[model samples]
Target: MRISPAYLKSGILVSTAGVFGSAFLWLLSFKAMAFWMGPEGVGLFSQLRQMAQAATVGATFGGTNSVVQGLAERKDEATRRQFRATAARLVCLSGFAVVLVIAAAAPLLTQFFLASSAPALVATVRWIALAVLLNVGGTYALAVLNGYRSYPYLALAQIAGPAALVMLLGGAGWWHLPPDPQLLSGAFVLCFGVTCLVGAFGVSRLPKLERALRLGALPKAQSRAFVRFAFSNLVAALSTTVALLLVRSWVIEAKGLAFAGLFDAGWTLTFNYTTLFLTACSAIYLPRLTAAVRPEDRRACMLKTAYLVLGAGILVCHAMVLLKEPLIHLLYSSQFQASGEVLMVLVIAVIFRGVSWVYGTLILATRNSRILVVSDVALNLMLLASTRYALDSFGSLQALSWAFVLPNFLYLVFVVEYACLQNRLMCRRDIWPFLLAGTSPLFYLALSGPQWANSGLVTGLSMVVGLGAAGAALLAYKKVVS
Candidate 1:
């Protein structure tokens, strides 16, 4: 059952291209939206998007992990069909329930997000709720695809959905549509609808992916287990969403709405690119981990994947940090110039988060729900406390960068240590190379306060170091596979 190096390499390349393609399109759509709406509008859109994402989590009732597990573990075709049928029924029912709840609470959502309950805004919230339903179905489809290791179809759905979204938004602008919440929300609906359709089509094309929907008897025990695992995922996800919401609100109250936009800008640049690597790696990595039975086998897979991610992440982090200002201008606009300062600090956090993500995948594969939930809660609480401390001490939006750095670094440490102890892996010794590569970017930034980004000597040295680390990582990965 060992995964082949050729398969892993090709799978990662295709997955990365697919993720990058979709991310690029989404970024373009955001850029267009930012140009039209400015910082405040961008911040509003971020918040609304966050709300829909949160609702999508609820709508799925946390079944994605369960679905993946059920589909991945079962050897019997009949059992797989029964599991798929039960999951589909649950997903549909839960999606309907969440939509109803959101429809009922539209006014409340408007007040919470917009600070006003105008008729138009409330209607916009309802529209976003419908988008959540589409997204929930899409999420289920993706989990099923993941269970089957259908990475090409996964990539197709990922790329095509966002491609449709970019086109829709581009067309709206060409038609000179108003840059309002309603229009933005409608674009979301279209995006999710297309993704859902593509995912469903992907499932249809794979005869092995077919579910026996007519199978009358539901597997209640398996359904409950899936739900229980999903609830754990839901709690972790909701904590993150709530923390971001609170952080944005506090930034608005302390500085202004525009300041919150700056926070969003920095946050986006730091995490979005990192997520691309993580998601692409997870596409192949998670299934392998799930199928791996021995501790040594799991450790080998985890180490190789971590090296691969860190190698790629180190290069990306340094490049973004060095080019933050110009990238901000190019990706966002001149109005977001100040966001570059925050981006510099946040990229450091990105390295830590990227390293931690490898270990987090281990946790997910092992299904240690308590550890997952507790660690997630701790991360968010630390985020809130650290950001509040930064605001109290520095009293500037730039200080919020500390909030991202400290929490992720600590979370990285926690996960690495726990992963070693829980699995009896050689993490302490083996982690040093990644730790050195991960922390190397912090020195210049800490000393010069983003001024180093402008220094040619610093940039050249960083590029050299980043390339060397990446090259070594790739060699190490090849060694592991061989």
Candidate 2:
């Protein structure tokens, strides 16, 4: 069951393209919405969308992992098909049940969150809730597709959904449609639906992949096992969501939606691109990691994946810090320029995040569900606790960056220690050099302007520093592959 390097490479290419391309479209949509809706609108959109994502996590629980586990183990077409069908039904049903819970609590949620009635915003929240089923359902299916190793099919759905979304949003804009939260959410819902539909088609056809759907039940024991695993996933999802809502509430209360928008934007810039790599890495590695029996194999798998992620991450963050302002203006707007500074500070967290994800995956590979849940919950709390303190103490937007950086570093320590103790793994990180290289650009660019009006000495030093980081990252990547 060892994954071939070629297999991993192919998945990496397709998955990277799909995720990155979709991310680009989403970024475009965010920019357009910012222009049409303003910071308040974008903030509302961000909140509602987060709610949808959080709810999806809860509803599906760890059903996705179960699906992946079931499908990955089942080489028999009939058996895998039946498992897929059964899991699909369970996920949709669970998603619907969760949506009902959200619907009932919607009023309370909006009131508590917004701190005002805000009818239109509440309506938007309700509208976005409808997307939960589609979102979770698609995720379940995608994981199944992923388990089947059908990268092309997964890529198709992944790309088409965003492609369709960009088109939908483009049409809406071309019509000079008055942008409201609902209209914008409708576009998002469309993306979810497209992904679900395409994934359904893709999953239904996988065999080497052409197995027809098996709407019939899987074995009773299998069904029970799926439920049990999914329960752990559900707890993990709920805990993370609670922490997110807590931090988000603090941000909105402390600085208004505008600052929240800046926070979200900066975060997206710093984190999202690496997520593309993480997604590809997980798809290629998870199955192989699960199949690995020896602790040596697991450690090698963990370190190799972590190294790859760190190398990719350092380069990406460095480029982001170097080009923050223009990219912000280009991707978003000048109103979002505050995001550039926030982006610089937050780039530091990418190191911890990338390395931590690798460590966390080791826990996941073992199916040590309790430890995984505990680590996730701990990370979420650490983030919320620190961000709350930062927001409360430092009245400036810059505080949010520290909020991200500090909590992530602490979480990295927790995960690293936990992974080592649990799996006898080592956390060999190469960070300081990358960090030095990544921040060099910001030092020269200055708070006054990114304009080249800075001292000549500082500018040369910054370029040298930035180039050195990029070079180190590239060398690290080469070292890993070699």
List all candidate RMSDs to the true structure: 2.5, 3.5
Candidate 1 is scored at a TM of 0.92
Candidate 1 local distance difference test against the native? 0.78
| TM-score per candidate, chains pooled | 0.92, 0.88
Please give, for residues 290-404, the per-residue lDDT of candidate 1 as tens digits: 8778888888888888787778777877778767778889989999998877777787788888878888877778877888789999999999999889887886656788678
Which candidate tops lDDT?
1
Question: Which pairs, if any, clash in model 1?
Answer: 62-230
Per-residue error for 446 in candidate 1, Å, reads 4.3
* C-alpha lDDT of residue 259 in model 1: 80
* Candidate 2 lDDT, 391-425, residue by residue in tens: 87886667767777777777777777877786654
